[model samples]
Target chain A: MQISTEELPGGVTRVRLDGRMDIAGAQSVDLKMNIVAGSAHRLLIDLEKVEFLGSMGLRSIVIPARAVHSRGGKVVLFAPTPMVESVLKTSGIDALLPVHHSLDAAIAALE
Target chain B: MLGLLAASMPEALSAWPDPRLTLTSQLEDLALVLPWLQALADRYALTASTRFAIQLCLEEALSNIVRHGYRGRANQSITVECAPSPAGELVFTIEDHAPPFDPLAPSAADAAPTPQSIDELQPGGQGIRLMRRFSSRIAWEPTPSGNRLTLAFPLAR
Candidate 1:
């Protein structure tokens, strides 16, 4: 999986994730987050292009959500695909986490 | 800390503190863990609706790990981890050292069941499909050793 990281306004880092996010898919994301761990104020992961999100993928998101939040920052998920939407909903993240429908919409919320 | 336990524990497949009893790793162990996993959900004293979903998810997931992950390799080892979340939730994890495989890939068909019992609907690859639908959170990580799969469920209220 390839995850593109872009610096966005309002101190938010926009991550454009593409490809399958699963068991073999977590290493890169974990590495990416570790690189930007303390440098940014927030991270908005763009899931629009992500073709798949599985249990392991959800954990990847949750770990970052907890890790970033603990540092007094936050991680926002943007535009998850339908496959991811059900997982988020069943996991209750759809209601608990901040998920946006578009990157622009997500960036706007950070401001 | 976890490695210490694995190293010191006696080799017992059906008993406690056995890190080797993963559902995906060994098909025979499925019966060992399935009943207990179900019993935990039952002990939750949850409403029927929630209990059914939980049971379905747990059973199917364990089955998937056994049938899909291990791929019938002899002497396979799948690690199943169940821990309690700080929020009083049950977090069940299954990991295995097999060839790289992702069971959650979306199938070509995206249609609803033709009205069968949720359990009987047996949505083909739906065990995992429902696991993602039923659990609070599911995550995976590939270690140098194997694939680490974790499923978290909120305790019944």
Candidate 2:
């Protein structure tokens, strides 16, 4: 998995995640995600390129989202693929970390 | 020589065979799983959603075996076999040599009240829930040596 970040207007950081978010993928990004969450007040996790999501992947997202949330920050997931979205919904992580289908809507959520 | 070689080949090679994958208890072995599933999906013409469900459930099951059942021990044997059922489902059997544990059984985690906020959320327990929600049917049995989990998905749907 690859994680890249962009600084958007209004102090939001767009962290784009690419590749499968399976066990290995989750492990590969866990530390970086925590670091990003620790610093950014508003986080937008772009999942457009993520092809798969499993339970461990859910952990990778939830833990960071929680870190941001505890710090009074906001996190929004952006444009997960259909299958990945289903995993999010099924696991109910979508409730904790809101999912937005559009770039505008996603950035808006962080704001 | 060519005719003799052809006759010597196993007759089963002419037919489509069930697929099987084996791995050690190490989490890194998971890297091998998706590509194997992709091959199965191509061979069986599985729908994208079906393939995704299988991958999700298998990862959940296997990871649980490695982490909790085997306690992250390395070199333990784990095997996964995929076969088509007569009932119009594709069944995946995951067998492990760890001590018996029934993941499907209702546990404290299942009974715990749902978290109302991110503060209350627990990151690690979602695996069993995902397996339950995504699989068409799930069963767990204690094998003589360890445990076996069977997850089935409808071939059509």
Chain A TM per candidate, in order of listing = 0.87, 0.97
Looking only at chain A, give the TM-score of model 1 against the true structure: 0.87
Query: Which 10 residues in a row give candidate 1 chain B its minimum summed lDDT?
Result: B114-123
What is the DockQ for all candidates, taken in turn? 0.02, 0.74
Q: Pick the candidate with the highest lDDT.
A: 2
TM-score, every prediction: 0.47, 0.90
Can you write out model 2's per-residue Cα lDDT over B1-157, one digit (the tens) per residue?
Answer: 8678778885544445448899999888988888888878877889989998999999989988989999988999999999999999999999998998888777823842456788887787788888888899999999999999999998885
- Candidate 1 stretches greater than 4 Å from native: B1-74, B77-157
Writing each residue's lDDT as its tens digit, candidate 1 over A1-111 gives 887788865778877788756445665687775666556668887888876565556666766665665677766788886656755665545554578886677777666
Which residue runs of candidate 2 sit more than 4 Å off their true CA positions? B1-18, B108-113
TM-score of chain B of 2: 0.86
